[model samples]
Target chain A: MSKDAFSNHPITPEELPQVNSQSFTPLSNTYIKVNLMCRLVFWLMVVSALLIIYWQPWITLHKLLELYLPQVQLAAGGFGLLSSVYGILADKNKGYAIREHDFSYRSGVIFQSVVSQPILRIQHVELKHGPIDRHFGLASLEIFSAGGAMHTFAIPGLPEEKAREIRSYVLTHSDIAAND
Target chain B: MTSYQNQWLKLSPVAIVYFAVQFIKTIGNNLFYLLPAIFVGYNQFSENALIIISGLGALLVFVAISALLKFYFYQYRLSEGRVQIHSGVFQKTHIDLPFERIQNVRFEQPIFYRPTNHVCMLLDTAGSNKLEAKIIALPKNIAESLKQEILAYKTENTHEANDQEPQTNEEQLLNSRSMRDLVIHGLASNRIWIVLGALAPFFNSLSEKFVKGIESFGVDVDALMASSQYAFWQYVLFFFSIAFVVIALMALISILGSVITFYDFKLTRSDDRYIRRNGLFTRHEVVMKLSRLQMIALQQNWLDRALQRVNLKFEQLNANLERQSAGTSGGKIIVPSVTLEEAHNLATETWPNNQLSSINYNPVSKRLAIRNTLIAFWLFVPLAAVLTYFEKTELATASIAAFILSTAFIILSWKRRGYAIDDNFIYLRKGLIGVSYRCFPIHKVQQTTFSQSWFMRRFQLCSVKFVLASGGQTLPFINARIGEELIDSCLYQVEALKKSWM
Candidate 1:
């Protein structure tokens, strides 16, 4: 093996080029409301299920609930409150950028990350709307590449029409570079 | 053009049988809990033969009807550089897959269809979780013709657009394994565990059959066991013989499995595609495009190192999940039991103009060894102390020995952890008992992550994970700065490269 293959340059994170996500257009602000609503619905279901089980006549666990219900409620309430705050913050932090050559997305509240995939490398784009999303007139645009199982980037809570438009644009670009 | 427009067709009549068999297999796979019930019912056939037969006949008839319906509904049409499939009786699904998006076209002829010259055609599209189309049983000629048409369309579209011209037209015979090598591979493969696990549930039945056979031969096994228990040496001898028999059986089973799977393995390259053909009974022929290859892994276990042999695996994009779960080689080509020189030759042939020797690897920080040792110590020391407190000296001794052995293994693994990066490719080599050296083209890297935990941040260490199109590779316990640099350089290279990944 040639010794020159190894470089003596010192490694540092500062040497890496910083990616500015501010250049990207921010997602719809209503996304935060939608996210909060989803979280609230999830917690509501859990709380209701607990209440239903606790209130069941067949159950002989009155004493057990007296001992555990307060503790469980405190823990669940604390977790729900913490997650609600995190969810709103995360939703605010999430944004996507589409350039002439590539697409980029910035995500994560604490450990921030910006990932970019070249438009030419994209394999397909999907526009999905769940029942809740449909009611809210919101959709998620999922971009996939020849890469592994996970989607390259999924920008959720876009206006349904906007998501469809982005999907069509991605489809066209991906088709042009399909042979790759 | 008129004939092509009229090419929409359903599968052959025999496809019903194939579909029925497939249905049964899928049910048997998913409904594993029902297997014991079925077995019990089968065993009581003499008592309830009429009822069991009638019930089984009804189930078979139901399966046949469903299969017939599925075969009837499934229709495929090929025209205008696109393959369209229409299937499903209730919620119909229509798929229009362009030739350019089709990553692979696999043709399979089951042994049952050999006489009828029928083949199963599977069309895999890029980025899709499931296959674009599966034509269960079509005439062999039609399937082959469709495959050629799709391939020709894809090549014509991409051939003229490629910046880099074709290297050569000459076909090269890369490597072929002999019968002797196959046997060696069988002996080397650690597949005995799979056989043993699969047969565990049937062990009782098998032992019962053995006992019955011996009794029929007038050998009193119960009396022998009772008598053997009275003498210490005899009991020791009996257990030793049993262990010997189990080991022999396991080895035989592993060897046979390997031979069946890897018989007559051959690899050949023509232009930009590598073709691998193997298998003793159901021959599998897989063709992979060189451009689509995501990673190449060279593996050598302790036994392999002792035998001076290695296994080379080539991973490609979008492997079928079902096939992989079935323990079949899916979108990966394994060249087993080749000498080191042969492996090098194959690697060079696959990536010509690249110096396989010039890449330099840098080992991870020595702190990794310390970290590993600390982890082993924390995990085992408490267990050993508890055992000692309980006066379980034998268990405590075993735990202490395990702690030592594991610590040594981690240190060895730490010594082996190294990564090398070049302008074109990134190489990662690690492992203790079995070393795996992976080489991935820089352009094929889809994502790069440099993550640090609180402990790692305190120690100025981090782990870098590279998610390639085929799979993921990680370099753990490296200097945080180095991880960042590596991720940045890889991303830069990936962005700058104009070449296609897949």
Candidate 2:
């Protein structure tokens, strides 16, 4: 095939549907509360572990606290505040968009990423919810493409009905593509 | 053969040897446990040679019995458009593979079975990373007929008639390798390092014995080492001589291995597929359908570049990405030691529209070097400072030198990184010393991802990743707008083409 005979009409960059241009739907509001609750549980476990260590016979609990309480408080306080801020920012920035021919998920605060999988390329779709997610009436959608052991994109913090709808839609579209 | 199509059949009794080899392989798999036992036995029973001999004899007998049992239990049946295999001694299994699901059928002729005119048939399925089935010791004519029957069934069942043309018996030779070419490939490749790594654990004892052997030659190695009578130049020359000998030996071993593996290597085309026949001791035949090709990789190391050679690999749509990248995928075909012109010709032949030599490559963003050098600065500065504070001037100098070298490497690698896009294909080239070119059709991309760090966002640069059935390839530090356009274009092509990437 010669270059001239191949008749190439290049698509204008502006005309192409850009992944970064799509308006993503934000995750449910309860997802943030669930995140806080999970963080609280983790902190509670850490405090319990510290208490167990403090309960030892090396020194009196009050005396040990007197020696290291301020330092520990400072470290934990700084970490907790930063983590809460980062979590809120992440929740604000993370979202998903389903286009006619493909779907994309945007995530991260500092290291942002947008993963797009064509409907024709998807192998399967799955819906999952953990105990906390179930308590909050939230679910996650996992999309897998061929050749990969892990899911291509796992969108979290979606309402159960929305997640189910997306899963069904992907399954139908993928089935059509497979049949074709 | 057709009369017994639906009935169970037994393999030749010569399969017992194959099974016994498999038993020995299982023992090799347990070498970690056995190595320690052997060491302890050597220490404890070194005086009792009879005990060790009897132990080995008993092991051989056990292996023979197990092989016999396994051979006795094995059976297979070829039903309508499918093959059923039943095997195993302690844990029996029955496998039924449809013609459409079997991705490839390969036949291997081990030297041991050559006298008996038997071959081992391997079935590669779409659901597994490794060969799914191995029917050993099949008579040559029966194996050939079985292969034809399976191919015929596959052609009938496959949906894409445009690509699944009926298989032709005619074989047209496409390429063959000479012994000189194989020798160059052996020297240019890095398989010797893998061999050395596997032998490293035994090197300590081996070196000690080597020194003792030298002593038996009446050379006072210890006295020569302890005495400072030799000049520094003499020591350097001695070290160089030893290094030279070791490298020469390793090169010879690597060349021998290459010859054994690819002695009479040949690539032939039959209909719309390619067949590669190679190996001296264990002849191997691999068939690859053209439509299943996902990517073509051409690699050149420093030595290969100097020798004007390129190593070509045709990567197919594999079931597992991890195994594919590990070079263990069942569907990959490697044609080693082709010239640069031949490589380009083959690439153009495979993908007619994508002329690799004509495609203009665009280098990646310069920020890659800046970001990495900045990272190195943050990492090595503190180490150098700490070393200087500890009064280790020499170590500090070395760290500074390392930082400079790393920064240079980063810049050089950044210069090497480039990507080009044609009408229907995407090509990526990257390396520090020896470049590798990867090309695949745009429609074969299964997924696309564009990522941005805070620094990259500030610079309006992002990295793009494309996931194909073979594996994922990344274009790092490209313009964010270009990255977005590439992803969008890949997704669009994949949706519009509707071509089966399998």
Candidate with top TM-score is 2
Q: What is the TM-score of chain B alone in each candidate?
A: 0.87, 0.93
Residues A1-180, candidate 1, lDDT per residue (tens digit)? 223355556645566453342286778877789889889888877777777776778867878776897678667767887899999888887888776556667777655555666566666678889998898899988877666556356788899989988877877763335443
Cα lDDT of model 2 overall?
0.84
In the predicted model 2, the residue pairs found to clash are: none
Worst 10 residues of 1 chain B by lDDT: B321-330
lDDT of 1 by residue, B268-320 (tens): 88777887777766656667888889888899888788898898988887556
Off by over 4 Å in 2: A1-11, A57-81, A174-180, B158-166, B195-209, B216-218, B226-232, B320-329
Model 2: DockQ vs. true structure: 0.63
Model 2 interface Cα RMSD in Å: 1.7
lDDT for residue A131 in candidate 2, whole number 0-100: 89
Worst 10 residues of 2 chain B by lDDT: B320-329
